[model samples]
Target chain A: MEVSARNALKGNVKALVIGAVNAEVTVEVAPGIEIVAVITKSSAERLGLAEGKEVYAVVKASDVMIATD
Target chain B: MEVSARNALKGNVKALVIGAVNAEVTVEVAPGIEIVAVITKSSAERLGLAEGKEVYAVVKASDVMIATD
Candidate 1:
C-alpha cells in the first residue's frame, strides 16, 4: 500500500499478453496515454490480469532515465 | 534509443533533487498523477533535466508488478 515511489496512476487494464515467463500489461491512465508494464507470468496469473481489470502499474525503479529530442 | 519496454510517459520535469551520485526526478504525467524516477547524477546532467523541461519518463523493467485492492 505504502511505497517510496511517488508516482501512482489509476487506470483500467487495456490488454494482457502472457508469455512463457513474462507478461506485458497495458494500463491506460489517461486518454491516449497508456503505461505498459512487463511482469512475471506467475505474478500476472496471481493478479488475475485481464482486459477491463483495474490495477496499478507499480514502477519502483532506482534508475529512471530521462530523454529529450 | 530503442527499448523493449513499452511504458513511455510524456511529461514535464516538475522537480529535481540532486545528491552525491544520484538525482531524483519528478515528472507530472497527468493532472494529479506524477511519476518519480531516480537516476544517476551524470545522466541527469547529460540529459539537461530541469524544471519545466519536456522529457519522457522511460520505464524499462523486467519485473514490473501489479497491485490491487
Candidate 2:
C-alpha cells in the first residue's frame, strides 16, 4: 500500500544546513528549529556542509513510510 | 510549485512513538533513529504517549519544505 505524501507531515520543520558530517548533520534553519540531522558520518562530511549555509532537509515519503500498532 | 515526494527522503528514519509530551515527543522507531519531534507541547502530551508504544511520526512534505539564501 502507498500513502499520499500529504500523510507524512511533521509541520513547519523547515531549515538550512549549518553543519554536515558523514552521518551527523546540523541545520541552522529558522527561528529555533535547529535540527541535528543524523545520517552516515561519511555522508555528512562529504556533503562539505558548514556554518551560515542553506540546504533543503530532503526526506522521502516512502523512506518516511510509517506503520503503527 | 510542488516537489515530487521522492525528493524528500531522509533515509531509514522509520520509527515508532515511544513517548509524547505535547511539544516534544519520542518515537521508539526502528534502529537508532529516535526522532525527538517538537510540535506544540500540548499536541505532545495530548497524544498520551508512553513507552513500549507505537505511533506514526506524521510529517508533511510541504511542511518539511525548503528555501535557500
Candidate 3:
C-alpha cells in the first residue's frame, strides 16, 4: 500500500511485547539502531508479526515533532 | 520535556512551509538524509522554527506503523 509517511525504515522485528490493548514492537534497522513502535494488539495480530520477520516501520510526517536541545 | 519515543534525530531545519493551520518542516539529519514533518501552526510559532535552526525530529512510538513489503 502507498502511504504518505516520509520515513520508512526496513528492519527485522527484534522483539514484541504485547499487552491488553497495545503491543510494543522493536525493529532493528541496523545492527544497533532500533526503532520502537507501540501499535494496537489487533493490528499486531493482523500483521502476523514475529521475531526475525522483515517489516517496515512507517511514520507519518504529520505525527513527527520538532524539538530543540 | 522528556519523550518516550525511541527515535530522536538531530538535524537542522532546512525549510518551512506554513499554511493557515499547519506548517511543513524539513529537517536534514545527515548530509543527504532529510525528515519532513507537518505540525500545527501554533506549535511551529511557539517553537520559533526557522530555516537553518538546529532541532530534533521526534516520533512517538505509538504513532509508528508497521508494514510488510
Best lDDT among the predictions, by candidate number: 3
- Between prediction 2 and prediction 3, the one with superior TM-score is 3
Interface CA RMSD, all predictions: 1.7, 9.6, 1.7
By DockQ thresholds, what CAPRI class is model 1?
medium
Off by over 4 Å in 1: B61-63
Model 3 stretches with alpha carbons more than 4 Å out: B30-33
For model 3, what is the C-alpha lDDT against the true structure?
0.90
Q: Model 3: clashing residue pairs?
A: none
In the predicted model 1, the residue pairs found to clash are none
DockQ of 3: 0.68
Residue range A1-69, candidate 1, lDDT tens digits? 687655567788998888999888888888998888788899889888889998887777574567777
Q: Which ten residues in a row have the lowest lDDT in candidate 1 chain B?
A: B60-69
Top model by DockQ, which number?
1
Which candidate do you rate higher for DockQ, 1 or 2?
1
lDDT of each: 0.81, 0.40, 0.90
Badly placed stretches (over 4 Å) of model 2 are A1-69, B1-22, B65-69
Residue-level lDDT tens digits of model 2 in A18-59: 334424344543343444455554443555445555564544
DockQ of candidate model 1: 0.73
TM-score of chain A of 2: 0.45
Q: What does candidate 3's lDDT look like per residue over A1-69, in tens digits?
A: 788788887889999999999999999876666778999999999999999999998888988999987
> Deviation in angstroms for B62 in model 2?
1.8
